[model samples]
Target: MKAVRYTLISGMLLLGMVFMKPTVVVSQCAMCSLNAENSTQHGNTQGKGLNNGILFLLGAPFLIGAGIGILWYKKYRTKSPKQTLLSHHS
Candidate 1:
């Protein structure tokens, strides 16, 4: 069952990666060029900063959830509740 679940998860991840589009990662200064192109009418300075800040803020939850998920998964990957109780009782 574990092996089957792992296989299915791996297959899905592989499929997702294969089908995903190559999107440019707009991090920090890398977004300058993109902002310059679109910042004409809005003016460059405030718009650029706002856009970058918004993107940064938008990414916060995803980052937090991923970190939490890693820790949560690690916590459950080893022993069972019964084993923990038995160890305590012993």
Candidate 2:
């Protein structure tokens, strides 16, 4: 019963997310956008470089967090249940 309820909830959430329209997020502040626009108007490549740098900076934390989570899961998942119990007893 509990499993069915959880599955239903998960399905609902999944469908909701699938049906949702994605929003465009502006990562740059007004000043940054203006600077990039001005640079682009002058035909400088700095604006494109700056945008790439911003995207890299924005994505870094999520990548680091996913790496840490994967490492943690790998470290813990290799232990048997009996070994885990014995370790707690010690």
Please report the candidate that would top lDDT against the real structure.
2
Q: Relative to the unseen true structure, what is the C-alpha lDDT of residue 40 in candidate 1, on a scale of 0 to 100?
A: 58
Clashes of each: 0, 0
User: What does the lDDT read for residue 31 in candidate 2?
Assistant: 95
lDDT (10s digit) by residue, model 2, range 1-90 = 866997999899989988894664347878999999999899888887887788788988989998999899878875434456668878
Cα lDDT for residue 7, model 2?
Answer: 100
Tell me how candidate 1 scores on lDDT. Answer: 0.74
Ten residues in sequence with the least summed lDDT for candidate 1? 21-30
Candidate 1 colliding pairs: none
What candidate 2 gets wrong by more than 4 Å, as runs, is: 1-26, 78-90
TM-score of each: 0.43, 0.51
RMSD of each: 8.6, 7.8
Tell me the spans in candidate 1 whose CA falls farther than 4 Å from its real position. Answer: 1-39, 42-45, 78-90
